[model samples]
Target: MLDLHRLRLLRELSHRGTLAAVAEALSYSPSAISQQLAQLEHETGVPLLEKAGRRVRLTEQAEILVRHTETVLGQLERAEADLAASLREVTGLLRVAAFQTAALTLVPNAVTALARSHPGLRLRIRQIDPEQAIPTLTARDYDVVLGEEYPGQPQPRVPGVSLHRLGRDPLRLAVPDSFDAADLADLASAPWAMEPSGTSPRRWAQTVCRTAGFEPDIRFESTDMVFHASLVATGHAASLLPDLVWAATPIPGRLLTLPGSPARTLFMAVREGAHDHPAITAFHTALRTSLTTLKTTLPLPTTEADPAS
Candidate 1:
C-alpha cells in the first residue's frame, strides 16, 4: 500500500510547486522531502516527478495521486470535525497564521476569549503573510489563517479551504505633519516608506501613486506597518497606511482618503469542512466580538473625503 504520509508530501509538492518551499513550510530538509517522495515512487512503480531545467514537475501519475489525496484529506478533516463535535468541551490544538496588522489588533482579543471560554483548547498564532498563509494552511501547517486582500489583488482560491469575510480595512495616506501638500497628488515626489515589494500594500500603493501622476520616491522598505506609521509620525517619510495601524492608538499623522475610499477585506480561512469544528467556531466568534469592540472604541478619524485606493 502507498504510504499516507508520503502521499501528503506529493500533494504538498503539487500545491507549493518546489521541494525547497515544501520543506521550508513543513520544517523538513529538501533532501528529506526528495527521499520520501522517491520512496513513494518506488512503492507505486511510476515516475512521479520529471526534471525541468533546475526545478521539477509533477508527472501525470503524480497529478492523479494528488486528486486522490485531496479527497482523502477532506474526508479526514470531516472525521476530525465530527469527532470533536461528539465531545462536550472544545479541546485540542488549533494552529493559526495571521499577518502583522491583524495579529496586533484583533487576534489578541480572539485569543483571550478562547482562553477564557474554552480552557481545554489551545491556539497557536504565527505571524505570516497572506501570500504564504493559505498554502501553508493547506499543508496542514496551520488550521486557521487571518488574511487581507487589496482592492485589485485578490488571492486566488486554494482547494480545500473555506474563506470567511471578517471586515473591510480602509487604506489611507499618511503624510508627515511637517510636510506641505495641499492635494493628495502633490506628494508624489516626496520620500515614502512602504511595505516591501510584491506585498499587497506595495502593489496597491504603486497603482494609486501612478494614477496620481507620479512614481513614489520610496526610500524605505519594511514589512512592519508600525514602522511605516512611525516614519510618518516622525516626519521622516510619507506612507500608505491602514485603518488597523490606528486601531489601538490615536491618529499619528495627517490622514488622506484614497480616490474612491478604497478598502481591503480582512478574512479568515479554515480547512474546508472544519469550519464547523467547535474550536474554529469559538475562534471565529471571538474575532467578531473583538472587531466590534475595535470599531466602537477606535473612532474613525475625520477626513476631507477625497478619492483614493
Candidate 2:
C-alpha cells in the first residue's frame, strides 16, 4: 500500500515543479522532503525520479503511480467528506487554481461570500494558466480549478475531469483613444498586444484578423489583461480583452466590439467524484453567485453603435 502522506508530497512536488517549492508549500525542510521521497521509492522498489541538472523529473513509472494516487486520494477525500456530512457540518480545506483574470476579478468576491456563509470551510487560491490548472487539479493538488475557453477554441478534453459552466464573458477590441477605426479591416495595419501563442484568445484574435484579410502585427505578448489594457492605453498596442479584465482595471481608451463580438465560456473543473463534497459544493455555488452579480455590476461594451448612439 502506498503511503498517502508520501503520495501527497509527490503530488505537491509535481504541482510546484521543484523539491524546494514543495517543501516551502508544505512547511517541510528540503532534506526531509527528499528523505521521504527516497523512502517512498524504496518501498515501491522503483526509481520514481531522476535528476536532470538542478531539477528532478518524474519517471514513467512514477507518472503512472501519480495518476493512480490521484484516484486513491480523491476517494479518500470523498470518504472523509461523507463522514463529515453525516455530522451535518460543512468543513474541509478547498484549494482552488484559476487563471489571472478570474483570479483578479471573480475569485475574491466568491471567496469572501463563501467565508461569510461557511466559516468552517478553509480556502486556498493560486493563480496559474488554465493549461497548468487542469493538470494540477487532476493530480489532487487543487479541489477546484476555474477555466475559460474562447469561442471557436474549445478547451481540450481531459478524461476523468468534469466541467461546470459558471458564466460567459464577452471579448472586445480595445483601440487607442485618439484613433477612430471603424472596423477590424481599418485596424489591420495596427500593432496588437496579444496573449501568447497557443492560448485560445491569441488564436481567436489571429483568426479574426486573418478573416479581415490581413495578419495582425503582434507587437507584445502576455496573458495579463491589465498589461494588455495598459499597452492599449499608451497606444503601444491594440488588443482583444475580455470584459473580466476590464472589470479589474479601468480602461483608458475606447472599447469596441469586433464584427461578431466573440465570447468565452468560463467553467469550473472538479474531479468527477469529488463534486458532492460540501466544501466543494459551497465553493462552486459561491462562484456562480459572484459571477452572476458581477455581470450586472461590471460595464460591458454596448452593441455596435450606429455612429449616433
Candidate 3:
C-alpha cells in the first residue's frame, strides 16, 4: 500500500518549494524528509523528483500524486470536522493569523467574546501580513486567517482555500494637519507613507492615486499602519488609511473619503473542507458579533462641508 504519510511530505515539499523549508515548518530534518521520499519512490516504482540547480523540482508523476494528495487531505479535514461535531464541547487550539489593523481592532474583542462563550476553546494568534499568512495557512500553519480585500483587487483563488466575508471597513485619505487637501489630486506632489510595493494595500493605494491622474510620492514604506498614522499626524506625510486604524486611538488628522468612498472587505479564510468545523464556526460567530459592537461605536462624519468633519 502507498504510504499516506510519505505522500503528505511530498505535498508539503510541493507547497514549500524546498526541502529545508518543509523540514523547518514540519519540525523534521532535511535528510529524514529525503529518506521518506526515497521510500515513497520505492513504493510508487516511479521517480517523483528531479534536480534543478541547487534545488529540486517535482516530476510529472509527483505532480499527479500531489493532486490526489490534495483531495485526500481535504477528505481528512472533513472527517476531522465530523468527529469534532460529535463532541459535547467546542474545545481545541485554533491558530489564527491577522494583519495589524484587524489584530489591533477586531481580534481582541473577538477573543474576549470567545473566552466568555467557549471556555474550553483555546486560541493562538499572530500578526502577519495577509500576503504571507495565506500561504502559510494552506501549508497548515494556521486554522484561520483574517484578511482584507481592497476594492477592485480581489485576491486570487487558491484551490483548497475558502474565503468568508466578515465586514467592510472604509478607506480614507489622511493628510497632515497643515496640509489642505480636498481630494487625492491635491496631494499628488506631497510626501506619502504607504505599505511597501507588491503588497495588496500598496497596489490599491497606487491604483487610487493613478486613477486620480498622478503617481504618489511614497516617502515612507512600511507594513505598519500605526507608523503611517504617526507620520501623518506629525506633518511628515500623507496616507490612505482604513477606519480600523482609529478604532482605539483618536483620528490623527483630516480624513477624506476616497473616490466612491471605497472600503476594504474583511474576511476569514479556511481550508475548504474544514469550513463546517465547530471551532471555526464558533470563532466566526464571535468575530461577527464583535464587528456589530464596532459598527455601533465607530465615529461618523459630522458634516458634508468638511471631509474631516
Candidate 4:
C-alpha cells in the first residue's frame, strides 16, 4: 500500500512546482523533501519526477497519484467535518490569514465574538497578502483566508478552494488637507501613494485614473494601506483609500467618491471540502456579525451617489 503521508508530499510538490517551495511552505528542508519523494518512488517502482533544466516535472504516474490523492484528501476532510459536527462543542485551533486592512479592522471584532460564543475553539491568525495566502491555504497552512478584490478586477478562481462573499468595502479618494482636490481628475498632477504595480489595487487605481482622462503621478508605492493613509493625512500624498482604514477612527482627510463610487469586494476562502467544518462556519458567522456591527460605526464621508449601484 502507498503511504498516504508521502502521497500528500507528492501532491504538494505538484501544486507548488518546486521542492524548495514545498519545503519552505511546509517547514522542511529541500533535501528532506527530496528524500521523502525518493522513498515514494521506491515504493511505487516508477519514476515520479524527471529533471527539467534546474527544476523537476511530475511524470504521468505521479500525476495519476496526485489525482487520487486529491480524492482521498477531500474524503478525509468530509470525515473530519462529520466528526466535529458529532461533538458536543467546537474545539481545537483554526488557522487564518488576512491582508493588512482586514486584519487591523474586522478580525479583532471577530476574535472577540468567537471568544464569547465558542470559548472552546481557538484561533491563530497572521497578516498575509492574498497573493501569498491563497497558495499556502492550498498547502494546508491556513484553514481560512480573508481577501479583497477591486472593482471590475475579479480574482481568478482557484481549484480546490471555496469562496464566500463577506461584503463590499467603499473606496474613496483620500487627499491631504493641504491639497485641493474634488475628484480623481483633479489629482492628475498631484503626487500619489498607491500599492505597487501588478497588484489588483494598483491596476484598478490606474484604470480609474485613465478613465478620468489623465495618468496619475504615483510618486510613492507601498502595500501598507495605513501608511498610505498616513501620507495623505500628513500632506505628503493622496491615495485611493478603503473604508476599512477608518474603521476605528475618523477619516484622516477629505474623501471624495470616485466617478462611480467604486467599492472593493471582500470574501473568505477555505479548502473546497473543509468549507463545512464547524470551526470555519463559526468564524464566518463572527466575521459577518462584526462587519454589520462595524458598518454602523464607520464615518460617512461626503460623496456623490453611486449610479451604478
- The C-alpha lDDT values of all candidates are 0.86, 0.82, 0.88, 0.88
Candidate that would win on TM-score? 4
What is the TM-score of each predicted model, taking all chains together? Answer: 0.88, 0.75, 0.91, 0.93
Candidate 1 Cα misplacement greater than 4 A, ranges: 18-24, 29-35, 45-47, 50-56, 302-309
Looking at model 3, residue 65 earns an lDDT score of: 96
Over 1-309, each residue of candidate 4 has an lDDT whose tens digit, in order, gives 999999989999998899998899889999999999999999989999999999999999999999999999989998898898888899989999999988998999999999998999999999999878987787888999999999988988887788998887888899988998777778889999999999999999998888889998999999998889888888999999888889844677888877666898889999988888899999998998887677667767645452322
C-alpha RMSD in Å of predicted model 4 compared with the true structure: 2.2
- Candidate rank order under TM-score: 4, 3, 1, 2
Comparing 2 with 4 on lDDT, the higher-scoring candidate is 4
Better of 1 and 2 by lDDT: 1
**Candidate 3 Cα outliers beyond 4 Å, as residue runs:** 52-55, 302-309
RMSD of each: 3.2, 5.5, 3.3, 2.2
lDDT per residue for candidate 2 within 1-309, as digits (tens), equals 889889888877776778998887667799999999999999999999999899999888888887887788778767876876776668878899999999998999988998788888888899988787796565567878899988788887766578988877777888888666867788888888998998888898899899989999999998888999999888888888888886688886888887765778889998877777778878888888887787767666567332211
Quote the positional error of residue 235 for candidate 2 in Å: 2.3
Lowest lDDT sum, 10 consecutive residues, model 4, at 300-309
* Alpha-carbon deviation at 309 in model 3, angstroms: 22
lDDT of 2: 0.82
Question: What is the TM-score of candidate 3?
Answer: 0.91
